[model samples]
Target: MAERKLLAGHAIRRLRRQLGLSQVAMAEALDMSPSYLNLIERNQRPVSAAVLLRLAEAYDFDPRKLNAAAPGGGADAVRRRLSDPLFADLAIDRHQLEEWLAGAPDGAEAFARAYDRMGGGAAPGAAPDAEAAVRREIERWRNHFPDLDAVAEALADELRMGAGDLYGAMAERLRVKHQLSVRILPAEVMPGLTRRLDLHARQLQLSEMLDPSSRSFALAEQLAQEARGEIDALVRGAALDRLGERMYRRHLTGYFAAALTMPYARFLRACEASGYDVALLERRFGASWEQIAHRLTTLHRVGARGLPFFLLRVDRAGQVSKRLAGASAAPLAEGAGTCPLWNVYEAFARPDELLTQLVALEDGSRWFTMTRCVRRHGMRVGGVAARFAVTLGLTTGAAGPLAAAAGVALEGAAVPIGLGCRACTRPDCPQRSAAPTGRTRVMPERETGASPFGFAAD
Candidate 1:
């Protein structure tokens, strides 16, 4: 087989810009002529493997990712997206889109993101809340931090953990390194708080309200501050308000905590070994449904990865508590794109039990989704139930190894779905609560149409 020439000009240019280097500076640094570098950046000339090696060695990058997997994958995705019926009227020629990507890769990404944020067909409204802003920041980066993962993996190895000893291991680290002991107190003492840091006493207090997993996560979150410099540097770069900034910082602490406890390399091995058996994982890592599920979304380390799962949690009222995705930009990643038809909502019917389903989105993407009802803060504290359903999913084709996909042929079993009510253009959907924007509902006076509320076809 002939080896394909690497015509990843945009990727090379993106790498250069990320390092804050001008084309001339970058060419000189790579020991290459400016003309050759210019030709590569413009997609006129192919980048040689030798040049790729130099760039990797000089900038400390993974050579394997220099071309971003399939170099044309992003362009192909954009082309598919533009082919949607909504954009059918526009000229979506492949050459133009490829030119746009080659000309300004960053700008093309920004435009795609803006389009994703449009929420079906709704007009732009108010600014996002702190939660939304934080979620977007996490999702924008695909909820993985390679730097934190690498750092935590080394630290986790030093701990030399045993099964069911995560809390003890992390707490001991705090006691020895930061002089903070772990104490569990009565729920009445902490009132509404789960974990509190008593700097004066040098003890971390936890409410009896926490389950084994919650207790461990609380400890891990405290230990995450050990990487304060790294976490803060990332947070400082984010465009957030004071409140939003603080919320983002808190979320980062949670992310770091998950990385430290689960530790990317070990966790990915466990996931692959078990075919993502959540029950076994729960016991192995001492994680709750939510903790382990959230960890699945962060398994984005190069050369080592689990299934690119998306995790979403929604309460009974249909309010989304959290959404995270690994390698995929799933439609469900949109906070407002929650389809009522999704099995995540159905999980509420059978609390604590897993519900597996195959669903097809409007874009013809098929996914294998797993949903389970989970409680916030672990095991119904004081009989005060705060229930939520967490859903994990990935492309059905990629999920071939998963047990659920064994006999899951999409032709006969896939359930059709759309983004959401307003963003969703499916007027025939019986579950739709709101009419789609710019479309009129055409209900018959004597009888219903195809659905209870019919609408004009596009």
Candidate 2:
């Protein structure tokens, strides 16, 4: 197959405009003729490899930005929006859609945003919910923030701390730099609260019910709030118009907490050396299973990177609370709990024990998954504790190295799984809760198969 030429004219124009550079100036920087640059910017000519290298060397531009799949890169998202059931009757062609995405990128993005706001309704100009919009933005970015990683790494170096001394260093910094005392309070005084900061008294309060690791994380979260300026700048640079200011700040703070707990370079090195061992890393860093799994999803730095793992947190009731995918992992669809056959659900049966599985999806793709159940500390001794199953998985093709290092065999028969019952097309799934949509159910007379619901043969 011939290699496709990169044609990201709109991206080029946007970058130039952002840098306050005219076409002539950009062309000069790239050592290209102004007319040729104009043609490239108009999508009439492809951005050649030489010019791509020149842009990188001269302007310090990210080469990925000139690729069609860069963040906010193309109209694929808009096309997916238009293909929804609401626009089924409207005749639209791929070429015309591409033209719109290329020539009028902003308008196409606006249309996509409006469609999202409609929330699958045919209604016009429906207001988008702020929380939902922020959630979508977080999903879009795959819950990874490189800027937060950089800031956290700098902070960790400045404090002269590693994974072991992170909590002590942060607490000392809080006391010396910010004059805030860390206090462990009883659950009665602070009901249903894990951590609370008293700005007036300059004290950070933590619940006594929390374990040592949880208390340390709470302190790191408080320190993250102090670095809100850096996080705010990152959110602003993201240019997510739908994300409300408050939601943006909250998510960024969460990012900071995760980053501070697992500084990028040190964590990445440890992950590689340990073959992505969750328990070992948790013990080493004084972090929890959920925290280690969540940190695995954020190893997206340019040069250094860990396995492209996807993390999923599901409650005992099977509701997915968080899902984050690394750069190379396949995305988990939103609004549906994964198939019950996956080890993620089974993890609840064996709490705190690492369960490994090879899952084969409906699309014929396979993945290696490891899951463990995590318990959240309650405010009181007899209080109900919240339990969640956390799963980390990678594509089977890329799982060889980590699986070998972690002493997991990849040659086992894989468990058949699906996105969800509603979306899955697997026939005769014993654990299937509901029949897949668009499939006709068949009922035999006095002769039922082992499976609950039978579907008509194709």
Tell me the whole-model lDDT of each prediction, alpha carbons only: 0.74, 0.72
Tell me the tens digit of each residue's lDDT in model 2 across 87-196: 54465887988777667766765665565555533367767656545644554555666667778878878777433477788889899888999998888899989888
Query: Can you give the TM-score per candidate against the true fold?
Result: 0.83, 0.80
Model 1 stretches with alpha carbons more than 4 Å out: 1-25, 43-53, 56-98, 109-125, 128-132, 161-164, 378-383, 443-447
Q: Can you tell me which runs of candidate 2 are displaced by over 4 Å?
A: 1-8, 16-30, 34-132, 139-142, 161-164, 238-243, 333-335, 403-412, 438-458
Please report, as a residue range, the 10-residue window in candidate 2 with the lowest summed lDDT: 68-77
Number of the top-ranking candidate, with TM-score as the measure: 1
Worst 10-residue stretch by lDDT in candidate 1?
A: 64-73
Question: How many pairs of residues collide in model 2?
Answer: 0
Against the true structure, whose lDDT is highest?
Answer: 1
Q: CA lDDT of 202 in candidate 1?
A: 92
- Scored by lDDT, model 1 comes in at 0.74
